[model samples]
Target: MAGKGVFEEIIDGDVYKYYADGEWKKSASGKSVPIINPTTRKTQYKVQACTQEEVNKVMEAAKAAQKSWARTPLWKRAELLHKAAAILKDHRASIAECLVKEIAKPAKDAVTEVVRSGDLVSYTAEEGVRILGEGKFLVSDSFPGNERTKYCLSSKIPLGVVLAIPPFNYPVNLAVSKIAPALIAGNSLVLKPPTQGAVSALHMIYCFHLAGFPKGLISCVTGKGSEIGDFLTMHPGVNCISFTGGDTGIAISKKAGMIPLQMELGGKDACIVLEDADLDLTAANIVKGGFSYSGQRCTAVKVVLVMESVADALVDKVKAKVAKLTVGSPEEDCDITPVVTESSANFIEGLVMDAKEKGATFCQEYRREGNLIWPLLLDHVRPDMRIAWEEPFGPVLPVMRINSVEEGIHHCNASNFGLQGCVFTRDINKALMISDAMETGTVQINSAPARGPDHFPFQGLKDSGIGSQGITNSINMMTKIKSTVINLPSPSYTMG
Candidate 1:
């Protein structure tokens, strides 16, 4: 497969280079990191492990390019973004294959991610043209005392350079979610793609290169975060940050100091089921939301809070659905694939053991082969068990029985992470009430917690994240409003 020259545009031999100043350059550090295939447990490719000095060079290039990129007309920027989107769509298959090999993402979903990223870029381009500024005329007669005339105009301006950090899951889609918005808003960007997902992201960056964005406007740095993370975030060259990850985001926020930050962090999304809910529909969503992508998603249903009256029935339906999921390699497009790494698999195993020791009942026999953990459904998951409150980030779904709507709301609100939550019921009034009380960024009345079919307002409350992210919100976050005021000379009154 390596000899086929599939990723030849972005990769040289077996190693991918870091992108800076419109060129793919080898690292001066003389070091590289292996990208392992989870299914085969083999190193499929390598990416540069750059030095802090290399990061400083990228920062300088981005800082130098910011004003020029921001000065470019908004229409031209949007046009280039559209072209990049087209390039991404044209190369979807190869990029998706890279995702499958790099991160164990199922083939079908990886294709969807690439296509969705293209659509997101296209949408951001369209929205960029519609970001309206404001003009207002003020009169002192509105106040009681003086006669004066004032006129004000306000417009959004780019916040210089934006540092984007995307997680391994949804690599293409999430990376574009940051890049396109930052570009459309007239800001230069420096992307730090996750180590496991860097190859696919670099391919995406290559699309932007084909689109003819100004040299140095978009750069990608690949390496261990511990080596260059602080230097990137703390550097004055970065004007704003848009990050999607876990605890790393918190650490970045502290080190990033006063620079603007838009983060989409960890989630412990809850699924609350009312007694009046449709058992069949509830069960289907639970399985799909909890186990899809092997439950690596931040918005994946982490816990199910069902009314005690209907807990037993819901568990039976959910278990039946889980039994039907196919488990195998991503090459075959199975429903559950091996997780990204062995340590992640070990962490999940620890959670399972903790639940078992504390009396949580597993519906199926526990099974694990290396990083491939079969789907697990735990019942009677008491609050005392770690599985009830902790996010497993694996194919483990815990069912916690609650007696009433109030009890469910209380438990959901008490959680530290609040990215999203869902409630299933036929009662519209009850659904509306729960939606209002839930402390999450989004509430699904009868559906599973998801990021989007459209880029609506997605965010988190407590530790989940900071700021809002959607098409417009993200653009707004990366730019700031600058207002110009003019005090008009007192008008000479002509007798009329």
Candidate 2:
């Protein structure tokens, strides 16, 4: 409340009275990290850097609240989600501001995120009713002389506590991706948002309380990833952990011990341009899909394989479009923005430099103003180059020329990441061929990878992630099935 916006509220038990639990307070650490504007590198506000113990308290409250919250009616639980969505929509302005300040995301992108966040909540609420179980049934019909046959229905139940770990990029939507489904499923949540972008999710939690949710039902702890992550994943009380970060996601999964897990790791997604494709349309879509979020999305296109005939033509068109994109402050409307961190900016610079040394020439040398790195293009990239194999997650696109569609498909599948990919071709057979050969979980034909409307089963194939998370998919990952049968002391079926 003291940092930026209005001091609103915090709630306790299924009510609207926000009781300040001291242990859940922001860090007492005097030193703070800068939350920068990627476009201008301007300091927004330095959030309180949380210690390990403070992060644990949120999960502790979750453990305390899980049993009682789980027993609440499914429909009633869903109502809280609906309420949260409504409140978030009403407070979109302030929340969007927080998002822009924290991560330097474009104003338009932030607004869309808030709306999509609400949609996620609504979707989860709808999916809640569908979790209903079937009635009991037995084998009485099969045996004419049998007097008894009963089998209890198999329906979903809460997985106690859910520790949701969201990334810095798209902080609001990614966090809600976990929160919505978990809350709708009647499970208490302990949200550990990125330390760099903690305010957005904090504002979201405040909105949740406004929607009449019990205080302990949803909680937050802002802190360093390594410390909070270790605590959350290894905690005995947490039944499952939902993670969305690159290396951090993997770390959480490994430390989950025996707990159920859901992960959405970053990717070096690819896009293929074929001979018969329209180069102009392909260029526009490529720019928007790849660098829309500074290439920070896990599904962002980092690799492009073009057919020999159209490689030069398509590259020129994409270069012209990339050059025209306006790079400015996230507060202002702009086609592109700066990379998220100074470290990230530096890394991209090094990657480009290294590639250039290895004969991969950039059409334009990357320009860096503080943390914001403008879009840079490089052609004649080989698979052996580090930039070709690794994920830049920045505004850098590297093109690799391939002779045939078959070779392009082979190169795309060679990477460890299997999150997303795209192909553009007039021939249905070629599209189908790449679709079958690509190792990724989600592949688009003439379209970029996306997770919109909150309905698809979004997951990865290999190292990208282990489990999936969406409206209904998130529910299924955290739950297991058990059979119940009542056969009137069924001695007839037993060999004994």
Candidate 3:
């Protein structure tokens, strides 16, 4: 697995790494899968895949090690995470290229994902140390004559284990948002990254190992999601499941049954451009949000709702912007890159075709090559259109026109997906009204909707997501409250 010229930089400790319980081991099934780069469709490397039985063994190891891991002082745990962050920074270049190769990310966006992930890990690590909890007495002898102090004060405490299922588009950032906090809060994790991005993710797992965490405390099992996903979700030992994707997140919710389930499903996010908004800025953000990461982000804007007063001008300008976008290999810094999988592109194109047949106007041809779905613009769309309500998760935007801001807000709320929505307007009253009225987890005004810093709570309303994620909320979500109380004796006993 190492010592080759191309892989010379990877150390023995970093390469051929395995799930550990203080020692490295092979998959019980002796089954392994070749990790592929979906962009170029090349096999990058191979990793061990756990059978259902092997999953149980890893879960057992996690359960056995949880208490010991939890007992370690909080500061030391924090320090280890900080070390992991340093290691990620040290390995950022190799990791970035790996992500671009696996997922076909433009070099710049690839760097963004890798670096942002390291920031998340480092942020969670520092936060874990500086924060803790204590119980307080409500009333005591220090209180006035007749009353006794007896309440409690506390902070977030870790759950035993969190199993994370990350998506193919964002191999590192999304998973780190879950894994970093779960670890910082002192919980063990078992990760199942998409088969395509497994190599970059495994390299990251090794970084955690190098950071000084003992084996099996933080582990991975890579294979088909169908093979081991059900086991991880339903396992008695998995106290929590953190998932990121579309229908898969919903499926996990079903299998989770009684376990605590946290999901970031999908969103039909919209960018509403009012007549009074700046044409240049609105057009810029529209293309940036809809096409960045090739439009694969859960937060990526999918629908553009424009007012008739400005629809024609806006459409012309936006089409001009879209036309300027270069669609080709990610290695060439193309404006739009290939979709993660061929099936995914096919799925999105079907939706676009449906919209076109239903009377939506097309501003450009929907291009497809191998697995890549090039940018496509659909205008004159109606809220009743399926493309308007469902997450395309591709480079297709269904543009609709409404009479007023109220109507725009109505259209935004019409979808079952409601992760995040953004409005472009200088009208403070209208902006305030939309931000307050829009039924979504986050509302952005004059900017594209996006996943921000690790400290802010990341979640959604309605079908978009359940529970929440972000540094603070994630710490709270991965932890449960346990009140500790102590009863004190009154100085004057009536019986005496």
Model 3 per-residue lDDT tens digits across residues 171-269: 787788889878878799888887767777877776787788866788777665668877778888999888887777777787777777778888888
> What overall lDDT goes with each candidate model?
0.89, 0.76, 0.78
Query: Which prediction has the highest TM-score against the true structure?
Result: 1
lDDT of 1 at 199: 89
TM-score of each: 0.97, 0.90, 0.92
Q: Root-mean-square deviation of each candidate, in angstroms?
A: 1.9, 4.5, 3.6
Expressed as tens digits, the lDDT of each residue in 1-496 for candidate 2 is 2123443343122111212232234355543445566555667555455566655666666777777777888788877788889988887887888788778888888888998899888888888667633333445546677554444445667778888888889788988888888877778888777866676777777777678777577877655555555766777778888888887677667667787888888787889889999788888878878888787888888888999899889989998989888887787867567677889888888888888889997788768788778888889999778999889888888999999887888888888888989988878897887888999888888877776557788888777998876777887775655456654564445356
Candidate 1 residues 258-299, lDDT tens each?
889999997889999999999999999999999999999999
Worst 10 contiguous positions by lDDT, candidate 2: 11-20
lDDT, model 2: 0.76
What is the overall TM-score of model 2 with all chains considered together? 0.90
The per-residue C-alpha lDDT of model 3 at residue 444 equals: 87
**Residue-pair clashes per candidate:** 0, 4, 10
